[model samples]
Target: MSDPHYLREAEKYESPIPSREHILSFIQKRPKSKRQLFELLSIEDEQKKAFERRLRAMVRDKQLSCNKNGVYRPFSNRGLISGTVIANPKGFGFVSLDKGGKDLRLSSQQMKLVFHGDKVKVRLLNRKLDAEIVQVTQTVKTLVGRLNINQDECYVVVDDRRIKHEIDIVELIEGCADNQVVVVEVLNSPTLEKNASGRITSIIGNYLDEGVEVDSAIHRHEIPAIFGDKALEESAKLPNKVLTKDKKGRVDITHLELVTIDGEDSRDFDDAVYAIPSKNGWKLMVAIADVSHYVKEGSQLDAESLERGNSVYFPHRVVPMLPESISNGLCSLNPELERLCMVCEMEIDSLGSLLEYKFYSAVMLSHARLTYTEVNEMLENKKSKLRKKYKKIENNIDFLYGLYQTLRISRQKRGVMDFDRIESQILFDDQGKIENIVARKRNDAHRLIEECMLMANQAAAKYLQKENEDFLYRVHPKPTPEKVEITRQFLTAIDLRLDGGLEPESSDFAKLLKNASGREDENIIKTVVLRTMKQATYTPNNEGHFGLAFEDYAHFTSPIRRYPDLLVHRAIKRALSNKHRERSNKMVELGAHLSMTERRADDASRDVEQWLKCEYMRDKVGECFNGVISGVAGFGLFVELTEIFVEGLISVRDLKEDYFIYDDVHHQLKGQRGGRIYRLGDLIKVKVASVNLDDRKIEFVPVSK
Candidate 1:
């Protein structure tokens, strides 16, 4: 059944009266007042109201707009721009321009008609940097939120903190209750006079359910959770084991003592490593799962994998890029099983410099499955029980460790910045509640595997560069002048100095970090220096990576999880086949899309972690703890508690003794009357005031000394 409003809109051209097209044409030809339109159409007194209604509808639909002169003109005539709305939680928003100019700000009143992530066209008002939404081209259709029921009245509060509006629920699904997490499908978009309305589509779980937070985040970010039917069907056709035909043109290295080293909980293994000491250097072989072999270009499986871009990992579960039949079955490099892989064989000198390398398709057997903990134990103590259990392959592990040390020396010599920051790991009880949060320690085994993968990736990138082929290079741009100057001022204020000029090299940042090491404020200084750099992204332009200090770099080791790595695999295969392939025409668009998906995964993971942290802190509201001042703003100080590493804000209003003023240059807050100052890295005691799960925020207040 077609909607009546859509029917009216569709048949607008067939109307006997002045059709919408005719009205737009007339307005575009010459701007006219409402009175002028009425007179020009020669309408009778009885038809005046109908004509006025049509004009109003046209304006509401954004087909036409009214200027300050009280004259109507077609919206397409001139001076209109289209962009995506980025709504703020404060009931205002900014439109990121499609043509790359300053973002135009929209007032709270103007924001009432649109939701976050909507696409709209706007006309700049006479006021500077402000615009009014002329039409909504696209509306947010599905949202993940929590339901709030008041007897017969209900509304869904959106999960995105930036979207301040609540959607009125016109219909409800069975078994849904108040404070339940749900997925809502918008039925009617908001207008200036009324809030948007939706119907609950699916109840994920109760708000406090064990895994509901991650489930909500998955839906909220719109990460592709389920594979399409065609993709799954395609995956089903793949063989369960590698056959002789599959390895026809591949090298057989089944005798090599290669092992897969991963976390204890990891199920899918994508890489296997083997190294041996040579006369002049070491011979390193890095075998990566050949995902490109099973999933061909333009296939349904390939399309779905590209859509996912990369696998999203939560602490409890994983949303894989490919179906389980492929990602965990055929593509995983399991131990003692013959698997297809792409091997990078490199010859490195004693100084850890890559002498040469070659890439080829191969059939390899992983000798054993190893864990980082066991490997670290073996390397640290040769007589350990686990070391004796795996003594048959211990020599190969030692060779890899030696290669890692050499590589570490080379990395240090190259002046690559390595920040030693603490990463937290959550331990869950049998009931799925967090038992504790502890800092994860990275051992030599982790660095060994990392250095091996780095060597393979660098070799692959250099191979493509030598052939002058177009491929996606992982590019990290230099910091801007403004950021560098700000960093310089901050360091100077801390009695330190940055040696490099305006455009400092990565080595300069490395030197500054070395100087700040072991100080009480080391973590704070490292964080600030990291903030002064740009995020690394994928591009075909071949800009060097500044942080890794690599002239040519690409992600070529994780094809089982990352789409760009799959593309790299395909490019390398083409090169091996003596066919120099050109870059895909959609490379730029694909790069941008992949970057967005990466950010989406990061944001969703962060959101879930924050929600879990907030839930964990809910019970300790009145407890006091020592913390460091991590951030300062006009509103308050952000303190990260030392005991649990949780951060909360101490609002300025709670500082009742004096009025606080923010000092931006020095990154501190000062009390006007009390003369007390709180700056970054200052240790203080704070009492937890409140926890708001809806906003994912924790509040704190200073404890009187």
Candidate 2:
């Protein structure tokens, strides 16, 4: 026999008399109790049960809310706002509003029924910014966590620390062991009385296994690790080499000497450059791989590429946007191989100003594949064996160096701010464990290539804007007044000042950075300025880039790795074909999604790096190292070790001296009794106290000298 509840639900679906829309419309007109609604609609005894079921469904969907007096009304009529909940590690949560305001605070008790990333309607409580969840509109379906089995009972603890609830496993898969990472599919959501339940669908591996830390981050961020069958099939069908027919409309520049310069371990080559002295100044050609020539729009490969947005580069691993067949094989500009490309040819005057430029499809052959180290060595040692060996293209390299110097002068004149921060590179052993961490160095060759790319990107952006083509712009807004004020106060504390009125330009920042160079507090000042600036994003609306001091900017290089570059190529192609295309609203949506994916990749990579660093520091407990104060907060100071480039927190409680007070305006902590000060960029000595692998954190304590 069927249950009465199931029968009633089935009956409601069959009959269309009291539809969801009808009930919503009726309640929206005016608030009414169930009896009033039933009487107003002239419901008979038999229809009463069906009407009640429909109303209940409406309430569950968050279309309506029922008051304690049994009165029903539209949710919007009662000041309820819908938002996505962001859970905190401490069991509380915040609801991020869609309209973009301050996040509404949710108490721990109010967050018990909902999971992280759940969409819910919330109503303001007595507090101005505090809210309580009225109803959940959507729930998370799956999560990645570590499995724990106690006797006959099993549960999975989610990797996201903010989600404080452990999912009770109802049906466990075979061979699942304790402390193993696994993916859980939610079977039932939590109620007022019970916790959420789930089933283990897949086991990743033991938490301590080699490369498992990165794997866990991949799952935690829900990054697509493998391509779909259709996408792979499409990639497999791509040609290994450019066909004769494919070069029909392309200008042949293979006779010109072009070279590719990248890192020693780089496998994918997306750009090649050529330079020569012209009558007026210099003629520069930048050839980028034509990825869109092979991957057509609306295809499976395009779909997958758009979803990935950009390649995520880890220390030794790379999750490429496109498959190797396309990114590294067919589209890569390998040496001595004829490849199709989109070229940006520019004529620059003696002042390094771009006088004129043109874009065209071209076929080119890379004469030599060089590394930054080799190029820098050749430039530094003119008469070296390596320079003599590559003498055929030595003149072109010299010309590039001259052009780079000119462009750098122009860039400085434009007041571009450059931060000289050190980035650490991780080295691994044969067993895939961390061996050491070293600083990655950048030289003139790197800057020369960057200037060339920037010129090409600017040309593309200007050309597209003139053609009135719809495309994405790389926009970076200036810092807000509040942030600027904070920066001003911090600079004053360091005995420096930032001019340029309320809205200072990039050149002003450049001057201040110049003044701070070689000072004891250079790194601290740079960090503060960088923090004050807003993050750059992609948008259809052109707001200009604040960091580079460019009036217009768009990503036009490395289409093999970035989807925005691919879209720029497509837009350029459309404009070349003389097609009058209007901007579609879909492009706006795509810009937002691509920006989100970019941030997602950054967060995942940072998580993996932190985990690996923690692992590297695990064996060095109690070892003392000289470090610099990288950050200061109310809780403690963050120190970055000088030798290993590892960072760890020195908690305030661990000071064990005079009580310290945090000075937010000065970005420092001062002892109330002893008057001891610990400011940013101060040299200090610290000892590693502990490492928590589960939390991906390192703790340190001050070492008395």
Candidate 3:
């Protein structure tokens, strides 16, 4: 049956229903039969049904609703729905409704008035999940970046690229400049036509400056590097040394001849090792700075540490997790001063199998702060100055070196794969300019510390696993079939193939690396193989780490900087006190957040490194260097330089000989004009054609004969 069309023949009556509101009002007063409704609407019987259908649709759409009897009433559920905005870098966003059912797909046009992390109220037009942003509820904090100035007002461009709105500044702040990054408090949000207004609270600094590393670290982790006065004052109250009362009934290993080994300029010595040969195997003790002893839970310092999650480190500076009073003094395992520590005592056999392990809270004193260079020199030449100065601690250092060699062999036997990836350490001159990019080499001493830490972490993981406790687990899942196939193809091209089928174990990977060690394609194959594996992430579930081939794994040794390690310490303490069974939901939540923040820190560090590297090469444009094809894309191929660890792209258009097509199955580019093929790991010479600081990108042109 056809429904009544209210618009049709409406002009015939003098005082007909004036509008939809009037018609709705007329129908609300009394119950109207179909015949009466037709007369009221002034329409034919067929048209009456159409009018009824239209009324029903309006009610269902929340535009209108029918009363219990027969009359119509306007929907009462009106105003707005509040939600959080999750935006993508592509400008589009999704308003995850707080009232909660399904998310509304907010287009870039609708989101033009909003920014990420903003609370918004949107009037839903349809139930199809695709809704427009009718209005914004509340604006959250805006990310700080460079502010663009105009005649009367200025716009504050956000550091977060996902934000599309520019906030207007009333007047110039004290330290804000053209390219300098600053945090602007959003006073007003821009709509379709209006602009956002903001006031500068803090100036980060010139983004191009070396000091910006701290700014990037803080901003990236969403942590406040600058501590509040109250927090700093609270940190000042901490004691300079462990009190005698706290050391009662605890093992005082202060005179154990322990030595700290780290970089030359490291301030906080969190870990110090002492080792000696035993009849059973080796007696190794790893003593970590007990920050927990000083920074008690729920204290100001502890709260701030929880907020920061972890310490952020750049090349030149480290934003310590705790105040310098603790990290560098009281809590630091400095020599002469007795410090509290959570020590891990372990017994290991000659083949690197741990026989027994014990954890304890104790008082320890470091005998000396030994730098890697000093120890390496002492090992290389016994007659060196360092060997003469620290002659007493030479036995312990030698024992540690022997243990590290044995541990490395054990790790290799267990099929642990280590990719020898090259990393550049940027050296800065007196003017805060990059003097040179030095490729960092892995040395025996470095590996020694790493192996010791790895052993401690493994022991921690095993302890947690045996306890059947719920803790933050470091897990790395296996590779995907597609990635495995790709790796296979690349390996086959390099005249090497896995003995097993597509699904090879960690041992297979280790053997492959060992077979290709010192070969031309070693680095390239390592890079590709690494890409095939999944990223290591922290989860509550106990899936083992595939890369390390560990049945269990958790970070334990570096509590000063890593939150996971702190949690592990807490877990260990609870287990020791027999209170580990009482679990808190909040701790688990904190672990997840900490893990996410750690990843964010790593990404931010990488971004700044790329920027600095590009800035370092800004003056060296047109210089040529030998490189290898690291990656191939549709647009270009990425080349990593041999001398300097800089990576740049070789655009396809620059290969002017012929048109090239990316061969996906083979992982190469085939040229049609000259039958030339460029595959992964192909060594080539490239010239630095240009550098784009805006995007932190570099362009390279292939150097041809």
Candidate 4:
């Protein structure tokens, strides 16, 4: 027992204590404590940690188990892996592993025993990591969906398509009818032998009601919408206008002539900026609304804000993170009104290098609430009426523009990657229906504001890092090796090369974009490169941002809308006031939750927008339109209409007269016999073939000239 497999373990690890095989075999008949195992294995003080680690490895690999009392035994479910089931709408699923790796694939039959979002333990069914659900550790308690009644039977067709099962309606809500949306409480979860069942808890409304799509998505994503009673009461007692008492212990920057630049229909303005020429370079100040000052720690408002994570914006309405009294009233940096703000003041050199920076609480007066169009016109067109009207602050605007240009040069030199992607704006009619979808163009004013915010964010990150405080940073990790390789293959086929070898820097990506500047497939190249990048997330660990090429970065602006920004504000205040005090221990958990909620908001918004787009295109079946191949996959090509901005799929099966082979690396489908390639960024004419509102999909067919 003491020496079995000892030589093999020694070969695999240096200073090996005990082999996993020996540990598992020793505890097979009876559970043993760590002390007993240590004594039995004759482990020295130096080898004690190694022996404990071997036990943990055995537990992780499902060879042994450790209970709450610190006793270990042979694992009952030896080969099962714990994970969360992520089911697809096509009757397949994947188990997102708890320890993290490639997901285990689950086929239709294997997925029958569990639903989407179920915490489960699975056993590997094949060598390909295909798995079968052995047991469900947790099941979803309720589902939001449309109630369907067929003659004598009833079921709920879930709003989340990823949940492929229709819950049998064993109990129904009174007055609920066909095609009505409702929430169903799960009375029974599916098993290998029995189907899932639920009872209707609440009836929302008719499926065709105006704006029901947004409402359904809100419930489907479990977004916190209504404020709690306590939070509302607290918000009601707050002052609508800035009070003199609130101005205490704050610097008065009311004479700075700061301006708030935003979209025409924007609300809840959170940041204002002003700049002036300095001896060396320029002095820039970014004042963000002090949201944390009003929402105190452990207060009701803070709890509500944490639950929301961030504000969810829709085309017609917004689900604010804080109550209206805070987000839109007291904290909004409205023009002609004094407001409390946390100011980031930076001293820089002529080349836009930061020399020093400081943060302080201040009272600011926004002289003008400017729109991007107005500012752009003011700078470019001196003869415009708007330019002459806002002439009082013309000098301030000029200085800010100068600062932006300098910062932009520094950014380029630092190898910041810029993706030239087109974003669509939905134009609504008087009745709130989408009239048309058009591309949105970004002008210099947009980049001007972005640069200022980026500077402030980076400064805050550096300050906190230097002070050694615990907080969240906006982090973007480098692209994976697999993605980099795929991008390399695609770049090579186009006669382009990605430098920096396996671990390419952002400069390499910038160089590729610059080389592709005048080409027809420029946007497509940008798109491919963009897809190769990973999504930026929040983390307590400062890994830096790859996209912006910043050495330190945190989201310091938009505290009224984002929770992490609020957290940053609190951390900064704490660091400035008491350097010796420790930061909150919940930063890690908050980072993960805030990141997840941000994604949740984005997905919910996208879901509603896609549904509306489907409705808009429903009447245009058989109409011919020109589109660009925006995406390519094995099943089909996603084509975005040039004028309308709607996207539809051209199925591979519809390509008659030849068999098409998909090349994912090149993002193209090549016809075997005809030798024609349809790839990303290729222009083509198509006709709307069909529309599926339930699936939020539009189908297209190729058209000949």
- For all predicted structures, in order, the TM-scores are 0.89, 0.88, 0.82, 0.88
* Candidate 2 structure, TM-score to reference: 0.88
Q: Tell me model 3's lDDT, rounded to 2 decimals.
A: 0.78
Worst 10 residues of 4 by lDDT: 123-132
The best-first sequence of candidates by lDDT reads 4, 2, 1, 3
RMSD of each: 9.2, 9.7, 7.7, 9.0
> Total backbone clashes of model 1?
0
**Tens digits of lDDT, candidate 1, 340-437:** 99999999989988998999999999998999998999899878898678877888999999999889888888888878776667778999998877
lDDT of 3 by residue, 555-666 (tens): 8888788767777887777777678654457756776777766776676777777878989899999999999898988787999998888999999999887899988766
Task: State the C-alpha lDDT per candidate.
Answer: 0.87, 0.88, 0.78, 0.88
Give the winner by TM-score: 3 or 4: 4
The residue-by-residue lDDT of candidate 4 on 178-240, one tens digit each, is 999899998888866777899999988998677888888888888999998999999998988
Which residue pairs does candidate 1 place in steric collision?
A: none
Better of 2 and 3 by lDDT: 2
